[model samples]
Target chain A: MSNPTAAMLVIGDEILSGRTRDANMYHLAGELTNNGIALSEVRVVSDDRSAIISATRTLSETYTYVFTSGGIGPTHDDITADCIAAAFGIPIDIRDDARAILTKHYADTGLELNAARLRMARIPEGAELIENPVSAAPGFILGNVFVMAGVPSVFQAMVAGVIHQLSGGRPLLSQTMRFMVGEGTIAEPLGALAADFPDLSIGSYPFQKDGVYGTNIVVRGSDGGLIDAAMIRLSNLLPEVTDDPE
Target chain B: MSNPTAAMLVIGDEILSGRTRDANMYHLAGELTNNGIALSEVRVVSDDRSAIISATRTLSETYTYVFTSGGIGPTHDDITADCIAAAFGIPIDIRDDARAILTKHYADTGLELNAARLRMARIPEGAELIENPVSAAPGFILGNVFVMAGVPSVFQAMVAGVIHQLSGGRPLLSQTMRFMVGEGTIAEPLGALAADFPDLSIGSYPFQKDGVYGTNIVVRGSDGGLIDAAMIRLSNLLPEVTDDPE
Candidate 1:
């Protein structure tokens, strides 16, 4: 059977404004890949309510799971929680459970649980809270969508809390063969070989290091034996002096 | 008036597979931001033809300009050229000018222009070629969409070539003020301030360094005077010991 597919939705104007380079998408991509959940697509939208709602709905419907980052803070622009609630047609408010979590954490830290801080207590109806070990604020899973913090550390922690709960397929296997030759020198044969084995994903990444052109051919598939066989064929096609099986 | 809005389409399986962290999106976002083009959205899709074509058409129609990266090489999975043609209903073939450029560059480097290398010459009808100074492979611009290389260096160079050609509005002006106070301590007042200035985008980025909590308040707008005025008000709201205007 095919792997369960997933998608990522990054919400924030900071990302679109180029003020913050996104770290969450890269982190989640690697996590999902290691877990064998195929991340098929990713979309980044601004802090607009309609944009967030539309993208969250589309991704949730298209994939088995959707993970969203950013806009869940206490600031004014942090509207992801509300937008997600609206998208799922559920009412959201400050839940006692969420409030209690924040209250106790703040009490331990000698901080006041003021009105602005209480914004973190707002949760969508009938959603499970994803734990945040680093900070007191919790991420929530509503339906198939997981809403997490935009901050890299908190987002990473939140993913760890729920990653083991999701059903995943076999971990994808990959093997790379590097060559000290230009991509054009091997493109034709490689393309023909790829056409022969349509099930495997064969990718060519070019690199120019120390003024020498080369390409790294990576063969990926669920079956390790199939990937191994494909790598052997690829190695035979390239020149003996240039190919370095890795 | 606001800046011209643009969207980015990243086409590749490597990014989605978690094999590669995308550098093009971050680089292009900064470039577009500096050029006064508002990057509204970014979509990352795999090497699938339908995904590429659909995203290309949608972004082209939705925004003032669309910038696509990846899938323009000579490999088997490099189907961006054909997809762009199909998206716009235009015929694609090896144009003489593009071929000549590649042929001359390869000849200078003592390389033969083989059939695989000639794939780099394919261009959609009526598209303008964007020169690649680092590599001979040319990027193209068809209608509102500018197709660029996936490689970071090459993409940056191509952007430099055409950035001056596009009409840009006033560059977005931003001023940042840092406070050594928690976000909760400032969220209420900050939210009220944001409500007053509907035209400007005010963002708060929180940080925790060396057991000291802080927030960076950034105000962005086309009008420098309005941003400055807002910053002055923000300075008065926060405590004097924590506020460090940057």
Candidate 2:
């Protein structure tokens, strides 16, 4: 079977405001890549309910799995759960299981579980809790949507908790050949080569330094042999191609 | 007057696919912040025309300025310029000004500007070209939307070229006070303080170490005096609060 398609929806105003540079996208992307699940799309929307609902609906319907990050905190802007529940046409309330977790954590820490902090316990109905080892507040999995945290460390922990349960397809293999040639010179042939290798995904990333121009041509595919074959042909087509040493 | 509100729309499938971790969002956010603009929202959509169009329309209408990155390349997936035109109900075609820039660059480099490359030259009618010094393929500004390249370096150059032209309000000045105290202890008082300072945006970011907990409380506002006053109160509230040393 082909790789399971996934997408991410990052919902936050902090991210867009330059107050926070998101690390979760990179972490999740790298994790998904290693797990053989193809992440096909990502939408970083704000805390607006309509925007979140619109994006979530579209992505959930289009991809096999949709992951969301942010807006699940204790603040008033933490409205992702409610938005997701609304998008799926389900009821959202304070779930017993989630509240228990939060209550226990707060009790152990000797802190008051105020209304604001209790906001973290509210989740969609009929959703399975994704445990947060770092913080007691749990994320949820409703149908294809996996609701994770906005904080980098918490998000990473939740991803680890859930990734093992997911079923993935063949891992995507990639080979990069960096050439000290300009993209303008390589575009035509590369396009042709990409067309020839319909199964392989060929990407040309251009970079220039001082006066020297180069392109890192990456060939990606599920089949290792097919990717290797494409790389061989690519090297033959562009003699300047050399393996990138990272 | 207060700082102008802004947002970003990152359009690319590659970014969502985990193939590319976007740098344009960070670059634009920082630039906007420095220019006294508050970036309120960000949406990273795929290459799908509908997704791009809807996101562009929504963000453009909501924010004072909307900057988009990616989907303006030579490849088949590159469709941002056309999408923007469609969103704004404007006609898009190969314009003379864009063609002139591409033609001049290709001519100077002695490279064949094929049909695919020429795709970069097509832009929406009435849009002004944003000069790209690194590559001659210009980004354009139509209404409030400033379309730019997906690549980090090129995106940086495009932002630099156009930042001076944008009308920005007073910059959002921030003062952060770091204290070796848990967020749970600070949340209530901070929330109360934030409510008092209606014009200021206050956020408490928590960090935990081995058996040690800390929070960095940031107070932001256009008025430096107001921010200072709030910070003074914050410092008094939490005696442990101290200035962050770079």
Candidate 3:
């Protein structure tokens, strides 16, 4: 991969139990792609200790950046921060910096900074806090692992805080060509187009809208010229094709 | 885990690239949970062959059943069947049964049964087909892995076809208790409730609606009575709490 590689580890039983849909992963994927980072893998494990720690260790070691969402809230089930600490064999507790932020925010909101809320201050040893403007509880970055909240709005905000700080390569460029034909009818030429432009990533997505079968041919690469070249070939291969997003 | 453990290996570049969100994982998670199977882990990898093969082998070894979505189409990007075959050391080719299904469907639809379309008929040596009512190109069952389509309708149809054949434990039971207070305000007593009901999985999720902060406490277990008992304690602990889904 030309760009930096990343993996998202989504931690929560709510998702595993099918109670909640995955929003953070989708948001992070778009942000990473826009920042020229290739999201290579994603894993969703329930709020279990061993599973969390094992996934953290593997993803942290494998990818350039590992972003985790969920399990950092102020509840007993919120064990992501502790799992990160355990994954790296680091001691974790309510850090002074995080505790201060929570204390100040809770005081302003008129909510008591009790032990439950105080649990949010538990940060891994020697980690930098990622600012949470939405909620006062901060996400911490331990090594390459960026631990954030599960809530979609909060996760998106934390990403905004973290994304600009990291180094990025050239943003990936993509173009789509729509053909009013099924994937089976267009597969052979699409495969040929993919082979011709070995550098670009070409994907065929089929859709059925209003009883009409169509396929979207998406070509992605950092080089605009190569993507254009691939799309031109696709258009020539199918005369009726349109370079449409719809 | 009292219920059978299952893992979902999502094979596609579309999800990782942020061009498409993960609808299949969410659908499968809910379906698996309702069928008395505990969806333990989910891994989403790109269209790369090695990544697909590695994930397939790992999840197959770890979980009781492995369900993979995407990459079963006729396009060049569709390499899931080949990857699954490679992972299990099986030779893959267009089987007569799958070909017959496709042949009949194409004859009915008046679409050509060309070589590109025939790629969908490639099945592993010993695999049984998972019928696709939405589309004729069938998904297949190879050992513990159930390879299905990426399209939501087709994947759901394939899942419905396969879910009933598997032996399942009792479906997981769950009850929700809502407190008109923040998670921080209710975390301690909720932790105590969780401790008392060791067999139950208790979770606290915070939400903000119309600027009002509240928390939803979800209690889940195989036994309905245990879930009810835990919910009662939660009500006793917080008298303002109501069993609400919203």
The TM-score, computed over Cα atoms with residue i paired to residue i, of candidate 1 is: 0.97
For model 1, what is the error of residue B187's alpha carbon versus the real structure, in angstroms, after optimal superposition? Answer: 0.5
Cα displacement (Å) at residue B237, model 3: 1.4
lDDT of 3 by residue, B104-160 (tens): 999888778989999999999999999999879999999999999999889989999
Candidate 3 local lDDT, A94-146, one digit each (tens): 99999999989987877688898899999989999999998889999999999
Task: Identify the superior model by DockQ, candidate 2 or candidate 3.
Answer: 3
Error of 3 at B70 (Å): 0.3
Task: Itemize residue pairs with steric clashes in candidate 1.
Answer: none
Q: Candidate 2 vs candidate 3: which has greater lDDT?
A: 3
Question: Which lDDT tens digits does candidate 1 get at residues A170-211?
Answer: 987789988888888889999999998888999999988877
Query: Which is superior by DockQ, 1 or 2?
Result: 1
B236 in model 1: Cα distance from truth in Å? Answer: 0.9
Q: Clashing residue pairs in candidate 2, if any? A: none
Q: What's model 1's lDDT at B243?
A: 34
Q: Rate the local accuracy (lDDT) of all candidates.
A: 0.89, 0.81, 0.90
User: Candidate 1: lDDT of B29?
Assistant: 82
| Model 1 ranges off by over 4 Å | A242-246, B240-246
lDDT by residue (B1-246, candidate 1, tens digit) is: 778999999998899888898988888888888888899999999999999999999999999999999988888999999999999999999999999998898888777788888999999989999999998899999999999999888888998998899898898878999888888888999999999999999999988787678888999988989998999999987655443211
Residue A86 error, candidate 1, Å: 0.6
Which regions of candidate 2 fall more than 4 Å away from where they truly are?
Answer: A1-3, A47-54, A75-77, A82-96, A103-118, A239-246, B1-3, B75-77, B86-94, B103-119, B209-211, B223-226, B239-246
